[model samples]
Target: MSDRAEKQTGGLAAVAGAAKQAPGRGLPPVHLWHPEHCGDIDIIIRADGVWMHEGSPIGRAELVRLFSTVLRKDPDGYHLVTPVEKLKIKVEDLPFRAVTLERDDGRLRFTTDVGDTVEAGADHPIVVETDPVTGEPAPRLHVRGDLWARIVRSLFYELVETATVEGGRLVVRSDGEFFALGPVGAGVE
Candidate 1:
């Protein structure tokens, strides 16, 4: 490995050690930790929601999930912050992707690619943004803190399939609340 890659591996190791020290009951309070900026890492989250490091895909799912716990998005960019260090990482799109959806007990829950389960309600709402240039759909769901899960195209279609028009808005009802997907007359697809 090059010297830069070698240096980043140490940061990863430090993050792994911190993850090991955290309690397994809930996620680490990354928002509270104001560690010193330790520069950027080689990690990159692709538009397809794949996590890569050093030009290769990270094969371990658990490790990826662990690193995600420390992820934070600021006005600058996304960073993986531990208690002692904060390392920035590149995100092509959103840091996470909602790959699956479940409806149970009149609640719509989304499962992210990294195993984060978020329900669409008052706490976690869904929003859609159309590209200004291409007019492509980009749907996102608030997960936690500043993190959001990108709703994949297929899942967005599924949402659209179950949507209904309410007050001239294309919306989906979850947990007794209506979330607008788009205007009633606009073609979301």
Candidate 2:
């Protein structure tokens, strides 16, 4: 392999090893690591939440989940970080997809494709942006430290079903915070 490719392969193994060595059952403390940038890897997180490495889909779900635990977002880009090395990756959109949602006692909890569960509230607020050209609403929930999950179409539909009209907008309440889905009567077209 070329030098750069070899470095990337070695870096991937290092990162996977570091992630597996995480002390407990929770995610690695990637936020606290200030490792030197090891350069970019040919990993791409597609808009649909598929993790691709070297042009093929990363077929191992467990490996993807493990890698997700070490992901960190910096001002420059998204990275997989270890205490010793940090390598950037490309994200076509948000890094995760909110695949399922549940409501309990007025609070909303969402599960991402990578197995992250986050409750929507002040800290993990939900936001919607309208496409300038299509005017369709794109909703997302903050997952963690600069990472957000695109709320999937089905979950967005569920949110709409539970939304109430407030101030001419359709809004849903989760953990005492209200999030606007869209303006009332806004067509999806």
Q: Give Cα-based local distance difference scores for all models.
A: 0.89, 0.91
Weakest lDDT window of 10 consecutive positions for candidate 2: 180-189
Query: Which residue pairs collide, candidate 1?
Result: none
For candidate 1, the TM-score is: 0.94
- Candidate 2 per-residue lDDT, tens place, 1-189, comes to 999989989998998899999546688888999989989999999999999999999999989999999999999999999999999999998999999998899999999999999999999999999868767888999999999999998899988888888899989998889988888878621
Q: Over the stretch 1-189, how does candidate 1's per-residue lDDT look in tens digits?
A: 887878799999998888767657688888899988889999999988889998999999999998888899988899998889999999998999999999998899999999999999998999888868778778899999989999998999999888888888788878887788998667872
How close is every model to the real structure, measured as TM-score? 0.94, 0.95
Segments of candidate 2 deviating more than 4 angstroms: none
Global lDDT of model 2: 0.91
How far residue 46's Cα lies from its native spot in candidate 2, in Å, is 0.5
